[model samples]
Target: MIEEIRIDNLGVITRAHVELGPGLTVLTGETGAGKTMVLTALSLLLGGKADPATVRRGAASAAVEGRVLLPGDAPAVARAAEAGAELDDDGSLLLVRTVGAGSDGVAGRSRAYVGGRSVPQAVLADLAEALVTVHGQADQARLRSPAHQREALDAFVGEAHRDTLARYRAAWAERARVVEELDDLVARTQERAREAELLRLGLAEVERVDPQPGEDVALAEEADRLSHAEDLRAAASGAHEALAGEADASGDALAATEVVDRAKRLLEQAGGHDQALAALATRVAEAGYLLADVAAELSSYMEDLQADPLRLEAVQQRRAALAQLTRSYGSDVAQVLAWAEDAGRRLLDLDGGDQRLDDLRARVHELDEAVAALAADLTQGRTEAASRLAAAVSAELSGLAMAGAELQVTVEPAEPGPYGADRVEMLLVPHAGAPARPLGKGASGGELSRVMLAIEVTLATAPDSGAARPGTFVFDEVDAGVGGRAAIEVGRRLADVARSAQVLVVTHLAQVAAFADRHLVVTKSTADGVDVVTESDVRLVTDEARVRELARMLSGQDDSEAARTHAAELLELSTVGR
Candidate 1:
C-alpha cells in the first residue's frame, strides 16, 4: 500500500505532500483547481510517461516520490533487491521519478530511483505492476478493447484459470519453436544436399592422396640428398684417402695413422727416462685408433652413396599431390587432416536431415494436442466464473439505481491464441425485455462507471480474489455522469471496497465525497489579473471545514444556508454505520 506521495513542480501542483492511509479518501475541488494533478503525480510514481509541458512554469524539472509499505516477502521486494535497491528497516520502499527537459528544449527524459538506488524507468514500471492499479476515464475507454475485456474476465476467475492459462502459454511456446525448426529444415533441404555432395568430393580427394602427417618434410630432405649425391661421395672418398692410405698405390705420403704410430713408438722407448714421455705415448696411441675408425666409416658411406633420377621424380610427384591437398583444404598436411575430421561430422548431420524433420514434426503434433487441452480447460473455467460474475454485477447495478438491468458475460469461440481459445466480452441489457448489447455501445458514461465499480466491488469482496488484487485502487471522475441516489450508491460501493484495501477517488459530487473517511480539498490561490502564476494547494479537511467544502461542491457557494444544511444531512447519513 502507498503510504504517502510527495509531488513537486508537477502540473499545477507546485509542491504538495499528501498522506494516504486505509479506507476511502476523496479529493474535491472546483473545475480548474488541479484535482487531476494529484492523480498525474501518482501515475508518474507508477512509471507513467512524463511530459515536460506538465512541469510548473520556470521550474527546472518535475518530480514525484512515493513511500509504499510492502510485505517483506512480496514479489516487488524481491524484484527491488535484484535491482540493488535497499529496503527500509520497516519494510517500506521509496520510489521517485524525475522528468527533465533536454538541452535542446524539444526532447525530454525521465530518471527513476527505487529505495534510494538509481534504476531504469522499466524497473519502476515492473514494480508498479505489482503495487497500484489506477482506474480513470482513459481506462474506461480501454473497455472497448477485446484484450482488456478478456483480461477482466480472467481476473474474475481467480487462480485456477490463471494456472490453466500459464500451461497453455507454455505449450504454445513449445509448438512455435518446433514449427520454426521444421520450417527452417524444409526450406534448406536443397542447400543441405549440396553441402553433403561437396563434402563427399573433398573427402574422396583426401583419401586418394593418402598423405601422412610429416611426409612432406621427410620427402624434401631425401630429395636434397639425392640431388647432391656425387658431391658427397667425392668428399668422403678424399677424407678416407687422407686418414688411411690410397687402396691401389704405395704409401707415397704418410697417412695420419702412420705418423701417430711412429710417435707412439718413440715415446714408449723414452718412457723409462721420464714419466711425462709415458703419458704422451698413451695419447698418441688413442689418436691412431680414432683416425682408423673414422676412415673405415667414410669408406662405407662412399660405397653406399648413389643418385637415381626415377626415385627423385617420384618424390617430386608425391610432393605435388600433397601440395594440391594443402591448397584446397589448409596451409599444410596436418591442417588438411583436421579439416577432414570436422567435415565428416558435418556430413553426418546433413545426411540425417530427413530423420530430424520427422522427429520435429512428431514433437510439434504432440505440443498441439497439449495446448489444445489446456486451452479447453481455461475456457471451461472462464465460462463458469463468467456466470457468477455476471449475476453479481447485475445485482450491483440494480442497487446503483439502474432498475431491472441485466449484465451478461459472453465467452465466444476464437482461434487458438497465446491466451486461450475464447473471446470474452461484457454485454448489458439496460431494461427488462431488451436484448443484450456490447458495453461500450449499450451503456451511458454513468452506467459504465457504475458497471466498473460493481465489478471492482464484487472482486474485492470475493473470498478467493483478495490475494491477486493490487493494494491500492484509484478511481478518477468515476461519478462523472451520476448524481442523487446513484451517486450515493457509487460512494457506498467504493467505501465497501476500501474496507479491505486502500481506495482514492477524485469526485465533484457531494454524495460521493460524503462517504469518505478522509476529505481533501484543492483550492486555487491567484494573483490580481493573472492566472499565469496561480498555484493550487491541497489540504486535508475535517468537521466544519469538510461541511463547507461539500457545500461548495453542491451549490458552488459555501455560504448558502440551504446547501450547508443539506451537506450536513448527507454527512450524517454517510456516518450512520461507519
Candidate 2:
C-alpha cells in the first residue's frame, strides 16, 4: 500500500503532501481545485506518460514521490530489488518521478527512481503494474476493446484459467516451431534434391579417377625420365667406357680401374723399404675398388634404361585426368580427395531430405493435436469463469442502484492464437427485457462508471486463492453521474473493497465524501490581482471543518445552516453500519 504521496510544482498544486492509509480515503474539493492533480501525480510516480503542460506556471519542473509499504514476499518488492532498488529499514519502497521542462520551446525530460536508486521509467512501470491499478474515465473507454475485455475475463477466472492458458501457450509455441520447420523443409525440397544431384555427380567423377596423394608429382618426374631415356642411357655408356675398357675400343684407351691397379702394384713394390709407401698403396687400392663399383652400376643402368612412347602417353593421359579433377574440385590430388570426403557427408544429409520432411510433418501433426486439446481446455475454463464473473458483477450492480441491469460476459470460439481459441466480450443489459449490447454502445457514461466500479468491487471482494492483488485502487470521478442512494452505494462498495486493500477516490458527491475514513479537501486561493496565478492547497479536513467541506459539496454554501445539518446527517448515516 502506498504510505504517502508528495507533489511539487505539479499543475496548480505547487506543493502538497497527502498521507494515505488503509480503507477508503476520499479527496473532495470544488471544480478546478487540483483534486485530479493528485491522481496525476500518482500516475507520474507509477511511470505514466509525462506532459510538460502539467507543470505549474512559472515552475521549471514537476516532481512526484511516493512511499509504499509492501509485504516481504510481495511481487513488487522482488521486482524493485531486481532493478537495484533498496528497501528501507521498515521495508518501504520509495518511488519518484520528475518531469522537467526545457528552456522555452525545448522538449521536456522525465526521470524515474525507485528506493533512491535511479532506474528506467519502464522498470517503475512494471513494478507499478503489480502495485496499483488506477481506474478513471479513460479506463472505462478501455472496456470497449476486445483485448481488454478478454484480459478482464481471464483475470476474473483466476488460477484455473491461468493454468490452462499457460499450457495452451506452451503448446501453441511448440506447434508454431514445428510448423515453421516443416514449412522450411517443404520449401527446400527441390533445392535439396538439386544439391544432392550435384554432389552425386562430383563424387562419381572422383571415384572413377581414384587419384592418390603425391601421384601427380611422382608421374611428372617419371615422365621426364622416360622422355630423356635415350640421352641418359648414352651418357651412362660413355662414363662406363671411361671407367672400364669398352668392348670395341683400342687398348691405348686405358680404364680408370687399370690405372689405379698399376699404381697400387708399384707402391707395394716400394713398400718393402718404407711404411709411408705401404699406406699410399692402400689408398690407391681403395680408389680402384670405388672405380670398379661405378663401372658396374653404369653397365646395369644402360641395360635398364628404355624409351617407350606408349607408356609415356599413358602417364600423360593419366596426369591430364588428375588435373581435370583438381581444376573442378581442388588445387591438387590431396585437396580433391578432401573435397570428395566432405561432399560425401553432405550428400548423405541432402539425400535424406524426404525423410526429414516426413519426420517434421509428423511432429507438426502431433503438436497441432496437443495445442488443440490445450486450447479446448482453456476455452472451457474461460467460458465457465465468464458465467460466474458476469453473475458476480451483475449482483454488484444491483446493489449500486441498477437492480434491473445485468452484465453479460460472453466467451465465444475464435481462431487459434497465442492466447487461446476463445474471444471474451463484456455486454451490458441495461434493464429488464432490454437486449444485451456491448458496454460502450449500450451504457451511459454514468452507467459505465458504475459498471466499472461494480466489476472492481466484485473482483476485489472475491476470494484471492493466493493470487496477488494490486495494493492500491484509485477511482477518479467514479461518481461522475451518480447521486442519492446510488452515490452512497458506490462509496459503501468502495469501502467494502478497501477492507481488503487501500482505495482512494476523487469525488464531488457529498454522500461519497462523507463515507471516507479520512477526508482531504483541495481548496484554491487567488492572489490580489485577477491575472495572478492561483494556488491549490490540499489538507486533511475533520470535525466541523470536514462538515463544512461536505456542506459546500452538498449545496455550494458552506455557511448554510440547512446544508450543514444535512451534511452532518449524511456523515452520520455513512457510519451507520461501521
Candidate 3:
C-alpha cells in the first residue's frame, strides 16, 4: 500500500501532499481542474520519462516522493533485500525522484531507501511495481501486447502447467547459448588461422635471437670500453711513465720518491739539533713510500690496457640483434617470452581444429533437440491454460454487463523464441453472431477498460501471478462512455475490487464518486501569473457539501435544488452501504 505521496513543482500542482489509505480513493473535479497532475507525479516517480515542459513556470526542478508500505513477506521486499537495501520493522519503503531543469537536463534521478540505506533505482521500481500498478488508459492498452497476453493467460491457469513452463525456459536458454557459440566459432575460424601463422612467425623470430634479460646492459658496457681502447691505452702509459719516472721521462731530483728520501736522511742527521725537524723527517719518509706504491700500480694498469677486437665485434653484433628483436616483439626479453607462451597455446588450440569442430556440431545438435522438446512442452501448457482463461474472463465480462461477449485466450504455435513457442492473444466477439477478433481491434474505449478490469480481477486471484497482496490499481476515466445502471455497476464493481486492493478512480460520475472510501476534490486557481492546482481530501463530506460537489459534477456549476436533492440521495445511499 502507498502510504502517501508528495509532489513539488510538478505541472500545475505547485505543492500537493496526498495521504492515501486503503480501499477505493476517487479524485473528482471539473475536466480542466488539473486532476491528471496527480497521476503524472506518480508516473514520473515510477521511472516514467520526464518532459521539461511539465515543470511549473517559476520552478527550477520538479520532484515527487512517495512512502510505500509493503507486507513483510512481499516479493518486492525480498527483491529490495537482495539489492542490499535495509528494511524497516514495518516494511515501509521510501522512493524519491528529482528532475533538474534545462534542455541539457539531468532528468529523473530515483533513489530507494529502506530503513535509511540507499538502493538502486531498479530496486525501487521493482518494489513500486509490486506495491502499485497504475492503469492509465495508456497502460491498459499494454494488455494488448503479445508478451503481456501470454503472461495473463499463464497466470489464469495457476500452477497446473508451471513445471512445463520452467522446463521450456531452461531448454530455450540452452539452445540460445549453443546457437551463439556456433556463430562465434564460424566467424573466428579464418581469424584464428591468421593468428596462428603470425604467432608461429613471431615465436621463430624471438627464438632465433635468444635475447636474455639484462644482456643489453652488459654488451653496451663492454662496447663502450672497446670503442675507446686506443685512447685508454695511451692515457694509461702516460700515467705509468710520470709515476715511475722511467729513463728519458721527467725524473725529479731524480724522481719524487728520491727527493722525499733525501729530505728524510737530512732530517735524520739534524734530529739531535731539533726534535721538530725529526717529526718532519718521518712525514717525508711516509710520502716517499706512498709514491712508490702509486708508480707500481700505474705500470700494472698500462700492461692490461690492450683491447681485443674479436670480443668487441661480438658484443656489438649481439647488441644489434637484441635491439632488433625488441622492436619486433616487445621492449624487453621478459615480455617477449610471455608473448611466445601465449602464442603457443593459441596455436595448439587452432591446430586441433577438427576435434573442436566435432564438439561444436555435437553441442548444436543436442541443443536443437532440447529446443524442440521444450517448445512442445510450452505449447501443450499454453493450449491447456487458454481454455480455462477464456472461460474465466468471459465470466467476468458478463458481470460487467457484456452478457453476450465472448472472451477467448487464443494460443497459436510460433517459431521458438526466448519466451517459448506460444503466441497468446485475447480474442473477443462483441455480439453473439460476430466473428472473434483481437481484443484491441474489437473493443471500444469503454469496452477495453472493462476488459482490462476483468483481466485484472482474474489475475489477482490467479496463483501463478504471485500477487498475494494485490497492488494499488488505478482507473483513469473508466466511466467514459458509460452511464445509467452500467455506470452504477462500474462504481459497485470498482468498490468491490477495492476491498482487496487500493483502487484510485479519476471520475466525473457522482455514482462512482459516491462509492469511494476517500474522495479528493481538485480545483484550479490562477494566482500571480501562475496556475496552481490543489487537492483537498473530502472523505468526511458533510451532507450539504456532498450535495454541492455532486451537484457541480452532475449539472456543471449550477446548484439547483433538484440536483442537490439527487446528490443527497446518492450520498445517503452510499453511506448506508458503508
Candidate 4:
C-alpha cells in the first residue's frame, strides 16, 4: 500500500500532497484538472522516462516522492540490502525521483534515490516495479501478454502449487543448460580433436628433454670445463715443470721445498737466541708442506691431461638440450616443470570418453518431462479458475451499465517459449445476442474501459492479487465514452477499487467526481500567469458551488440550479457509504 504521494513543480501541478490510504481513494476534477498529471507524476516515480518539458514554467526541476509499505519478506528488501540500503521494521520503502535541476540537464544529471541512498535510474525502476503496479488504458491491454497470463492463472490457484511451479522452473533451467552444453560440444567437436593432437605433441616434446631442476646450472659448469681443457692442461704443465725437476735447469735444480727445509734446520739450532725467529721458521716449514702437496697434484694432473673429443661432444649436446627446454617452457628450470604438470592435467580431460556428454543428454530428457508435468498442472488450475474469473468480471461489467457483456479467460499452450508452454487471451462479448470474441475485437473505447474495469475488479478480489500487484493503479479516462447511468456506475466502480488500492482517475463526469473521497477541481487561474489550481480554492463547497461544478460537467455551464441539487444528492449518497 502507498501511504502518500507528493508532487512538486510537475506540469500543471505546482505543488500537491495526496494522502493515500489503503483501499480505493478516487481523484476527480474538471477537464485538465491535473488529474492526469498526478498519474504522470506517479509514472515518473515508478522509473518512467523523464522529460524536462514537464517541469513547471518557473521551476528548474520536477520531483515526486512516495512511501510504499511492502511485505516484510518481500524480495525487494533483499535487493535493497544488497544495494547497501537500510529497511525500516515496518517494511516501508521511500522512493524519490528528481529531474532537471540547475546545471543538471536530462541525461546523467537526473537522479533517483531509495531509502536515503542515491541510486542509478535502473535501480529505481526495478525497485518501483517491485513495489507498485500501475495500470492505465494502455496497461490494461497488457493483460494479453503471455507471461502475465501465466502469472494471473498461478495467482488464482493460490498457494497449492507454488512449490510445484518452483520445481518446474528449476528443472526447465537445468534442461536448458544441458542443451546449451550439447550444442557447444557439437559445434567444437572438430576443434577439440585438433586441440588434443596439439597437446599430445607438446607433451611428447617436453618429455623427450626430461628437464630436471638445478640440472641447467650443473651442465653449464661442465661445458665450461670441457671448452677450456687445452688451456688448463698447458697451465698445469708449466707449473709442474717449475716445481718438479725439468730436463734442463738454468742456475740450480733444487725444488723451493728444499730451501725451506734448510732454513727450518738452521732456525732450530738458533732457537735459544730468538724465540720469534724460531716461530717464523716453524711457519715457513708449514708453508713448505702446502707447496709440496700442490706441486705433486699438479704433476699428476699434467699426466692425466688428454683432451677427449668424445667427452666434449657429450657436454655440448647436453647444454643445447637444456637451452631448448628453457626457451620453450620458461626462463628457468623450475617454470618448465610447472608447465609440464599443467599439460598433463589437460591431456586427461581431452582423452577421457563421452561420459559428460551422455550425462548431459540424460539430464535434459529428465527436465523436459518435469516441465511438461508442471505445464499440465498449471493448465489444470487455470481451467478451474477461468470460469469463476469470468463470472466475477461479468458481474463488474453489469454495474458499469454493460449488463449481458460476457468475459472469458482462454488458456492454451504457446509455442515452446522461455516462460514455458502456456498462452492466455481474454475474450469479451459486448452485446447480449452476439457471440463472444476477443476483448480487442468487440469492445469500443468506453466498452473496453468497462471490460478492463471488470477484469481488474475480478483480479483484485483474488487472494494473491494484492500481493502481486504494483502499489498504485491509475485509470486514465476510463469514463471517457460512457454517460448517464453508465457514468455513475463507472464512478461507483472506481470508488470500489479505491477501497483496496490507490487509484487515480481522470474524468469529465460529475457522477465520477461525486464519488471521490477527496474531490479536487483543476482550474486555470490568471494572476501573474495562468496557474493550475486544485479544488483547494473551493474548500468546503456549499450546495451552490457543488451544483456549479457538476453543472459545468453536465451542461458545460458553470452555474445551474438543477444540476446543483442533483450533485448534492449524489454527494450525500457517496458520503453515506463512508
Candidate 5:
C-alpha cells in the first residue's frame, strides 16, 4: 500500500504532500481545484507517459515520489531486489518519477527510481502490476472492449489458468513459424526445380570429364618436356662426350679420361722419391673416380632422352579438357573436384524435394490438430472462469443498487490467435425480461463505470490474488454520473474494497465523500488579490472543515446551514460500519 505521495510542479499542483493509509481516502474540491492532478501524480509514479506542458511554468522538471510498504515475501519486493533496489530503514519502498524536457527543452523526458535506486520506467510499470490498480472515466470506456473483457476474465482465473494460456501461446507461436516455412517452400517450388536442373547439368559435365586433382599441372610439365626433346638430348650428348672421349676420336682433342690417366701415371712414378708427391698422386686418383661416375650417368641420360610426340599430343588434349572444366567450375583441377563433391550433396537434397514437401504437409496436419486441441482447452478455461466472473460482478452490481442489472460474459469461437480461439464479450441485461445487449450499446456511462468497478472489486477479492490485488485501488470520478442513493452505495462499495487494500478516490459527490476514512481537499490559491490563479495545494480536512467541504459539494456553497445539517447526517451514517 502507498503510505504517502508528494507531487512537485505537476499540473496546477506546485507542491502537495498527501498522507495515505490502509483504507478509503477521498479527495474532493471545486472543479479544476487539481483533484485530478493528484491522480496524475500517482500515474506518473506508476510510469505513465509524461507531458512537459503539465510541468509548472518556469520549473525545470516535475517530480512525484511515493512511499509503499511491501510484505517481506511479496513478489514486488523480490522484483525490486532483482533490480538491486534496497528497502529503507522503515521497510518501505520508495518510488520516484521525474518529468523534464529533452536537450531541446521541447520533447518530454522522464526517469524512474525504485527503492531510492534509479531504474528503467519498465520496472516501475512491472511494480505497478503488484502495487496499484487504477480505474477512471477512461477505464470505464475500456470496459466495453472485448479484449478488456477477456483480460478481466483471465485475471480472475488466477495463475493455474495463466499457465494454461501460456501453453496455448507457445504452441501457437510454433505453429505460426512452421506455417510460414511451409508456405515459403510451397511458393517457391518452381524456383527450386529450376535450381535442381542446373545443378544436375553441371554435375553430369564434371562426371563425364572426370578431372583428377593435380592432373592439369602434371600434363603441362610432360608437354613442355616432349616439345623440347631434341634440344634437351643434344645438351646431354655434348656433356657426356666432353667427360668420356669417343673411341674413334683420332682428330679430335684428347679425351679427358686419357689426360687424367697420363697425369696419374706421372705422379705415381715421382711419388717413390718424395712423400709430398705421393699425397698428390692419391688426390688425383680420387678425382678420376668421381669423373668416371658422372660420365656413366650422362651416357644413360642420352640413351633415355627420346620424347614421344604422340603421348605429348594426348597430354595437351587432356589438359585442354581440364582447362574447360576449370573455366566453368573452378580455378584449377583441385577446386573443380571440390565443387563436384559439394554439388553432389546439394543435388541429392534438391532431388528429394517431393519427400520434403510430403513431410511438411504431414507436420502441418499434425499441428493443426494439436492447436485445435489446445484452443479447445483454452476455450474451456475461459468458459469456466467467465461464468464465475459474471456471477460475482453481477452480485457486486446488486450491491451498487443496480439490482436486476446482469453481466453475462460469453466466450464464442474466434479464429486462432495469440490469445486463443475464443471471443469473449461482456453483455448487459438491464432488467428482468429485457434482451441482453452488448455493454457498449446497452450500458450508459454510469452503468459502465459501476460495472467496471464491480469487475475490479471481484478481481481484487478473489482468493489468493497475489500480485493481482495490486495492494491499492484508485478510482477517479467513478461516481461521475451517479447520485443520491446510488452514490452512497458506490462509496460504500469502495469502502468495502478498502478492507483488504488501500483505496483513494477522487470524486465530487458529497454522499460518496461522506464515506471516506480520510478526507482531503484541493484548493487553488491566487498570487495576488486578483482572479489570476497561481497554484493549487492539497490539505487534509477534518471535523468542521470536512463537514464544510462536504456541504459545499452538496449545495455549491458551504455557508448554507441546511446543507451542513445534511452533510453531518450522511457523515454520521457513513461512519457507523467502520
Candidate 6:
C-alpha cells in the first residue's frame, strides 16, 4: 500500500504531499484544481510515459515520489533486492520518477528509481503489479486492444486455465524445435550427398596408395644412397688398401698391418733386456690386431656397395606415388594419413543422412499433431470462460449506475500464435435496444470508465482472480456521470472494496466525498497576486471543516444552512456502522 505520494512541478501542482492510508480516501476539488494532476503523478510513479507538457510552466523539471510498503516475501520485494534497492528503516520501499526539462524545445528524458537505486522504467512497471490497480481515462484506450481484453479474461478464468496456457506454450516450443531440425535436414540433402561423394573419392585414392607414417622420409634416404653408390664404393676401397694392402692392387702400397707387425717383433726381442721394452712390445701387438679388424670391415663395405638401375628406378617411382598423395592432402605421408582418418569418419556420417532425415520428419509430424491438439483445447477453454466473464462483468455494470448496460466478451478463431488460436474482444451494449459494439466505440468516456471499473472489480473479487489482489486501488472519475442515489451506491461499493484494500478516489460528488474515511480538498487561489496551485492549496479536511467542504461541494455555498445540514446528514449515514 502507498504510504505517501509527493508531486512537484507537475501540471498546476507545484508541490503537494498526499498521505494515504487503508480504507477509502477521497479527494474532491473544483475543476482545474489539479485533481487529475495528482492522479497523473501516480501514473508517473507507476512508470507511465513522461510528457514535457505535464511539467509546470517555467519549472526546470518535474518529480513524483511514492513510498510503498510490501510484505518481506513479496515478489516486488525480491525484484527490488535484485536491482540493489534497499528497504527503508521502517521497511518501506521508495519509488521516484524524475523528468528532465528538455533543452532547445526537445522532449525531456525520464528516469526511475526504486528504493534509492536507479533502475529501468520496466522494473517500476513490474513493481506496480503488487502495488496498485489504477483506472483513468487512459484505460479507455486499453479496453480497445484485443490483447488486453484476452489478458483480462484470462485473469478471471483462474489458475487451471493458466496452467493450460502453460502447457500450450510448451507444446508450441517443442514443435518449433522439431520443425527447425526437419527443415535443416530437408534443405541440405543435396549438399550432404555432394560432400559424401567427394569424401569417398579421396578415401579411395588414399587406400590404394597405402602410404606409411614415415615412408616418404625413408624412401628419400634410400634414393640418395642409390644415386651415389659408385662414389661410396670408391671411398671404402681406398680406406681398405691403406689399412691392409689390396690383394688385386698392382701399385706398391705397403699395408699398415705389416708395418705394425715388424715394430712388435723388434720390441719383443729387446723386452728381456728392459722392462719398458716389454710394455712397448705388448702395445705394438695390440695395435696390429686393431688395424687388421678395421681392414676387414673396409673390405666388406666395398664388396657390399652396388648401383642397380632397376632398384633405383623402383625407389623413385614409389616416392612419386607418395608425393601425389601429399600434394592434395598434406605436407607429408604422416599428415596425409591423418587427413584420411578424419575424412573416413565424416564420410560415415554423411552416408547415414537419409536415415537421419527420415527420423526427423517423423518427429516433426508427431509434434505438429500435438501442438494442434493443444491449441484446440485452449480455444475451447477460452470460449467457456468468456461466457462466464461476460455475465459477471455485465452484472457489475448494472450496479454502477448503468441499469441495462451489458458487457460481452467474445472469443473467436485467430491464426495460431505463441499465445493460442483465439482472439478475445470485449464489447459493450449501452442499453436494451443498443447494438453491441467494441469497448472503445459507441460509449461516452464516462461510461467507458464505469465499464472498465466493473470489469476490474469483477476480476479482483472473482474466486479465481489468477493472482493476488493488489494492496491499493485508484479510481479517477469513476462517478463522473453518476449522482444522487447512484453516486451514493458508487461510494458504498468503493467503501466495500476499501474494506480489504486501500482505495483512493478523485471525485466531485458530495455523496462520494461523504463516504471517505479521510477527505482532502484541492483548491486554487490568486493569492500572492498570482494564480498558483501549490502544496498550500491542498488541505486535509476533518470535523466541522470537512462539513463545510462537503457543503461547498453540495451547493457551492458552505455557509448555507440547508447545504450544511444535508452534508452533515450524509456524513452521519456513512459513519453509522463505524
User: Per-residue lDDT for 187-266 in model 2, tens only?
Assistant: 88898888899999999999999999899999999999999998898899889888997434555537778878888999
Across 431-527, the per-residue lDDT of candidate 6 in tens digits comes to 8889999876777776776777778778777775664588999988877767787677677778877888899999889988899988998987775
Preferred candidate (lDDT higher): 2 or 4: 2
* Tens digit of per-residue lDDT, candidate 1, span 1-578: 88888888777777888888889999888887777788888888887888888887667888889999998778999999999999899999999999885456575678999999999888888888887778887777777667887887888888877887888998998899899999999999999999999999999999999889998889989889888988888888878878887433664546777777888899999997999999999989999899989989998888788888899999999989999999999988999999999999999999999999999999998998899899889889889888888998899899888889989999999999889899999999988999899987878888888888888787778776522777889999988789999998888888888898899999999999999988988876664533321223678899999999999989999999999999999999888835
lDDT of 1: 0.86
For model 3, residues 267-380, the per-residue Cα lDDT tens digits are 999987998998998888888789889878877867776789988899898988888877877787677777778878988998877677788789879877877886787777
The TM-score between candidate 2 and the true structure equals 0.77
Estimate every model's Cα lDDT from 0 to 1: 0.86, 0.87, 0.75, 0.72, 0.86, 0.86
- Pairs that collide in candidate 6 are none
Name the lDDT value of residue 563 in candidate 2: 96
Clashing pairs in 5: none
Residue 195 displacement (Å), model 3: 2.6
After superposing candidate 2 on the true structure, give the runs of residues whose Cα lies further than 4 Å from its correct spot.
52-61, 102-109, 205-345, 464-468, 524-536
What are the models' TM-scores?
Answer: 0.88, 0.77, 0.79, 0.81, 0.81, 0.73
Model 1 CA RMSD to the hidden true structure, in angstroms: 4.1
Q: How accurate is candidate 4 locally (lDDT)?
A: 0.72
In the range 340-362, model 4's lDDT, one tens digit per residue, is 78878977876662666777778
Worst 10 residues of 1 by lDDT: 527-536
Identify the runs in model 1 with alpha carbons over 4 angstroms from their true place: 106-109, 228-305, 464-467, 527-536
How many clashing pairs per prediction, in order? 0, 0, 1, 13, 0, 0
| Residue 422 CA displacement from its true place in model 1, Å | 1.1
What does candidate 5's lDDT look like per residue over 306-407, in tens digits? 888888889889988999999999999999999999988988988888888898888888878877887888789888888888898899989888889899
> Which of the numbered candidates is closest to the native, going by highest lDDT?
2
